[model samples]
Target: MSGSRSVADRSRPVDGKRVVVTGAASGIGKGVATALVQGGARVVLLDRNVDAVTAVADELGATAIGCDVTDEDQVRAAMRGAAEHLGGLDGAVNNAGIVLNEPAESMSLVDFNRVIAVNLTGVFLCAREQFPFLADGGGSIVNTASMCAGIVVRPQPQVSYNASKSAVVGLTRSLAAEWADRNIRVNSVSPGYTLTELVRSPELAPQHEQWSSLTPMKRLADIDDLVGAYLFLLSDQAGFMTGQDIVIDGGYTVW
Candidate 1:
């Protein structure tokens, strides 16, 4: 009881925190950033699309930085910029990623490597750069993984995506362990197929029924459904939690 915090403190843990979110121009990243701002956190939105991200940042009253996560130099600059904008960093969401639905048998090496570079290596670069800013006060880092890391989805042959996401889980655990002494908590959120813009496109709309039928919840997740887990990880409520993956897949992986 001596060290316990009030319920209000735990409930509004992310208020006044300085947080950065990558790939924030759309989808899950945008949803998380919006939530952070609404929760009273100073947020910086980062994405390779400068115009789009800047627009979103302006709309949300947050800062924006154009950063291609796959590029180390760009990632370093973006992290520094975010730190400067917010005075320092308290949390980071490494959510930049890509997926290709190419068949493994005929997938070009270039295509495979490109996915790895963005999805896996990009996370490593962002986390590595964020360490310096977060090390000072013991911050949290949340990486975006996928339910595909545990089980492959049907009707799609995305070997590269599956492989990259699986590695993200491993990377999250490794970083959490290595940085525990520095008091930097690292964790991941693995969301099942969400109805993001890409997923809502005409090309993929036909597959929605198939995807929904596979989930025990009988539906896909909404961006709102997944942002709460990210907010929790970034808050002091999860002070002792690290190196864990919160899978929000509507029971898709259960089967």
Candidate 2:
């Protein structure tokens, strides 16, 4: 009781909380990890990139695990380790994902399944594995969905990516309802098109113009622009919120 915090302090937007973040070695994950540390939360960074994640952990004074979300064994092991390190799990940000830009006509089953595995199945695994850890403390879960989940990406082919993201939305809603009794709120953030290494690829560069034009804001989202939504969802401030999709798309989905 000597080190205990007041209720108000714990309820203030992720203060002194412990959280696990997937894909946390770089990009949006890195941004979230940085913000979480600044906001006073102990963060566990998980990613497929071992060295990179470890380096990030050292830099941020956070825990790091090299767990690929698509692999159940690795995820389980990582969660166990994270819980051990943090004393318990209070929330998680499942942000690990990949994208494929193949046309439906030429898309192979293997490639399509790969996308689903990482984007859809990965989320499912994280949520399921996180339940045991979160239920005890009334935890929060925020999955990274996309505006493409609700709206189609144009001037390119990404049928697999679109389908996978769409499934994430449905998954979030279904789990939110079923898990409400445990006080484990579930929600998602649909970032329009955030500026990150993934989006800065030479192949995706051309599509940037189309994506910006579609959004009334005339620009893609920066990682800075999207971390706040995630921070809110994983905080007690969103206690009354669940089964929701906070679309930070700059009005892209509005049209």
Looking at model 2, how many pairs of residues clash? 0
Expressed as tens digits, the lDDT of each residue in 1-255 for candidate 1 is 365778877778789999999999999999999999999999999999999999999999999999999999999999999999999999999998888888899999999999999999999999999999999999999999999899889998899999999999999999999999999999999999998975787767899999999999999899999999999999988989999999999999989
lDDT by residue for model 2 (130-247), tens: 9999999789999999988997878778999999989999999999999999999999998989999878888998789888998899999999999999999898778889999999
Worst 10 residues of 2 by lDDT: 1-10
- Estimate the Cα RMSD of every predicted model relative to the unseen true structure: 1.0, 3.1
Clashes of each: 0, 0
For model 1, the run of ten residues with the poorest summed lDDT: 1-10
Model 2, position 106, has a per-residue lDDT of 95
Provide the lDDT at 251 for model 2.
87
Query: Candidates' TM-scores?
Result: 0.98, 0.95
Report the error of model 2 at residue 167, Å: 0.7
Candidate 2 wrong stretches, greater than 4 Å: 1-12
